[model samples]
Target: MSDSNRTDFTNPSTFILLGIPGLEEDHLWISLPFCIMYATAVLGNFTILFIVKMEESLQEPMYYFLCMLSVTDLVLCTSILPKMLSIFWFNSREIDFLACFTQMYFVHSFSKIESGILVAMAFDRYVAICHPLRHSTILTNPLVAKIGLAVVLRGVILTPPTILLARQWPYCQTNIIPHTYCEHMAVVKLACADTHISNYYGLFSLCFVTGPDVFFIAVSYTQILRVIFSLPTKDAQLKAFGTCGSHFCAILAFYIPGLFSLLTYRFGQNVALYFHVLLANVYLLVAPTLNPIIYGLRTRQIRNRVLHLFTHKET
Candidate 1:
């Protein structure tokens, strides 16, 4: 028998995820905290959706963007939580090749979609604040729908090429993935075939996705700031920026760590495995958890609508 084929028979065709290597011994300690974070993330984003939908007062471009953001957060959390919880709660590490690719695809797809949506939101805010006289005309319902369609198309198209490139590579080597979820780069690295194409796509993906999105967001905020500063009334300036504070914070939380991780990994920085895993979890959790809190706290109308719903339900 060939020595290479001598892998453990029971775990063939799939790999067990080691899951944040050094902390495996203390897995129990983290389960409760992760569970709390997951629940809060889900419930918080769901509340945002509920508040947006039930409140007619929020039927505007900004609220529409907020609702889309909430939905993206829900999908993003779902993509990571089940796999992570399974590893933590049951110590189950078996994920089939197909399943792993599927997870990677959705994770990548939704993340890209979220980035696009944030860009769209920035545009909405820019128009609303910087060009108030023409905001309603430019950001009509049809225009928003078209932007949403473009976002979906961008994500759907960009994701498949990465998945196909990863799958085409031969994986005659060991399949042990180091983390809980199926990270594309990590999975591609396991392949026995040449991964130069995957690496190229990886770099291109970062530049193409992150570069333009960040540029648009920065420009939008700059214009927003310009308009706010031009206002003579302090109350007007405060109110204008107030509308964007939550989104800006959410964007910072989502983008900075992600870029840091990407740059560090690409440059061969020896980041701790746990740091990567923890940051992934935080990036997924923090945006969702904060989206609801930021919007709900900043926007009085949403707060009142949620309270009214609860009060009506209780009575």
Candidate 2:
């Protein structure tokens, strides 16, 4: 494992992924749960997308955000699940360096986009519940479209530099990436060259992407809570809080694990690797898997519309 004997990146046919090694022997057993989760996530998000698209009555700013979230989840799951399944099923762990970088880029980029989308969704709930009169004018379709564009722009800008920084590092000892996928720090740790720039850029990225987004989400919820408490009637207060229930659950599920993973990694905790893998899969699988269920179960309008649509199609 020295620089002198390392294979050149250009000539290598495939690179090995040093995934969780103990699971390698039990690939089939590991794959069973992964496949189930992946399928559930994909199908769930797809159903939401279809329901949103096919139902005219469900068209609104809130539903627009939900649709955007579904699409984001679909893309996120598709990006990571396939490679993971291939590794588990076919024992095909080798990946091209460029391909690995590409995977890392998309994984991080879509994750950023999903975070932005969740914030936007929370804001939509805030407006609808806290400022009902202004909600219609403020969150109109054109405004929602603009928000979507901004989310995409945010994701794209954050991704390129990270990928470029990654590509600059020359591999010395090994190309094997631990813990399933091409995580930024894991891959960079294998490089012989200084990763100071990469580490700096990663810190800046964490702040830029998660900082503002999570801040806005908190602000939105705070305003929402204030409005809820000011309501004269218990029913009104309950209704206001209920409006944000789904978004709130989704935010906690998505952000808590992610923030914990970053914190553990930055502080050099022993549990960092364990939490990283656990949370990485959470982003790709858990959030998306639960999103459709949460939305459909929490929102009566969406559920009713879906039922009606299905009834009409069948008739």
Candidate 3:
């Protein structure tokens, strides 16, 4: 409503989000699960933060990174979910042009930051397992803080250029975005100007976020695997690998949906449009919902703290 209503415009005063193309009638019904996902993400991520804050013993480099992941999950879920539900339930689909671009930037920014945190987590696990004697010395509070800063800076720096490119383009063309949120490409496609630069930059942003992060993760795991195999006993190896179970699960939950959604749009031309939109939405929302669940179930200390917190509350 705050958007200036000007019909003849470079960028239209507002853009309309279709929520999910080809599934208009199902929006009401679909809100059920989406609402539940948002709730679960909120509660789960908050619980993770709470447990990490309350239990001093659990406050280490690892939990610090987990806390970063939880915070990212919180932002990722919140950035798009409320607007999505509003669109679904209230039919309020108008987002201002600047706001839409801002949403896209933050969505991608926090998303990449999440990936960076996972990479940092992989490094943390590798250090802890591969160099047990020097784990504390290697991953001190200052180093962890620096890594956190670097992760934030990575997202902040990498995600903006694409959105900035998108922003400069004229939008005298249709302002209807077919997806729920302001996805970078979806919005870019709405531009009347030639978007070769935006499109190419978008691809660059994708690779820039995924490529090196994946490389570091792969290297960390490879070294970790080597260290585990070199151990004297199978029990020791299993225990060493076991320490990374939660992080591994968290990584899978975050990346699988993301890569699936990304590739689906790029290669799955036969897939339904609504399926792509739905998958994109899920790709955005599911990690936050699942990250805490993965950590809560798989990480022993946080699990124990969570149980203790609830049990203490009950008594």
Candidate 4:
């Protein structure tokens, strides 16, 4: 009997990725928005990088963190979108077992790094606003570099265990993953072996890796708001709000969809499977596409520099 027909444990060499379950027929059309989002993510992030690189006045801990954010957005989206587009456009669905695992790791790891970057950015804002005089001294270039390295290293070190634990399972069940990409839990569910550990570990990684980030961001913003409200002048208060507003929106863009996706998957079993899959893609894609617009286009310094470049080129 073939592996699919056999009852004993087996590891399939390849898995079939069902692009969007019930929405398979709509994939060609669906790719349109996804394609646009990916393109925007690429163009917008590069634009931020360009502005930060070309404008010396834009060099600060915040912009440096923005650079890290742009790069993470690029990698995070690139990790899955290209393959997802393949599935959408060309109906290419077969992924090697190893490739599937690789994709799962990249998707999870870079996302963790992105969350870390958001935390770092929040801390930057907190320091800048709450301790203005000490902002430069506290977040010096060396410290910024270390912060970047720490976030990057955390993602790299922490994400592999998800893949490792899942890989140990024998694929004695169907290798067909009814999702757009090789999501970690989706892959784990394919294992015929008991997956309580894998499932528990998934929750553990989410809590351990992302729980602190969310908490830090919450605390940072709480202090930031307290400082903002205490400003003597209304103008100063509004100005502070203006500066942090965009950052806050970017935070919402990252976390809200993400939290919804996680909750829906773990609890909302009655939710349509396609909804869950689309929400998964949203957390990964929407933030990347929106961050550049939120920060690069909205922030005064970066916006002014972007305008400077455009005006100079036009002249």
Task: Find the candidate with the highest lDDT and give its number.
Answer: 4
Model 3: weakest 10-residue lDDT segment is 1-10
Cα TM-score per model: 0.92, 0.91, 0.92, 0.95
Clashing pairs in 2: none
lDDT of each: 0.82, 0.80, 0.86, 0.90
Candidate 4 has its poorest 10 consecutive residues by lDDT at 1-10
Supply the global lDDT for candidate 3. 0.86
Q: How many clashes in candidate 1?
A: 0
| Residue pairs with backbone overlap in model 4 | none
What order do you get sorting by lDDT, best first?
Answer: 4, 3, 1, 2
Which lDDT tens digits does candidate 4 get at residues 123-150? 9989988999999999999999999999
Deviation from native of the Cα of residue 41 in model 1, angstroms: 1.8
- Candidate 2 lDDT over 77-179, as tens digits, reads 8887788888877878888778888888988898899999999988887888878899999998999999999998999998899889988877856667776
Query: Residue by residue across 2-67, what tens digits does model 3's lDDT show?
Result: 355644568788999999998999999999999999999999989989888988998999999989
- What's the count of clashing pairs in each model shown? 0, 0, 0, 0
**For every candidate, C-alpha RMSD to the true structure in Å:** 2.5, 2.5, 3.7, 1.9
User: Where is model 2 poorest over a 10-residue stretch in terms of lDDT?
Assistant: 6-15
- Candidate 1 per-residue C-alpha lDDT over 69-173 given as tens digits, one digit per residue, 9 for 90 to 100: 888888988887888888888899888878888888988898899899999988988887888899989999899889998998999999999998987777765
Supply candidate 3's per-residue lDDT for 146: 98
Off by over 4 Å in 4: 1-9
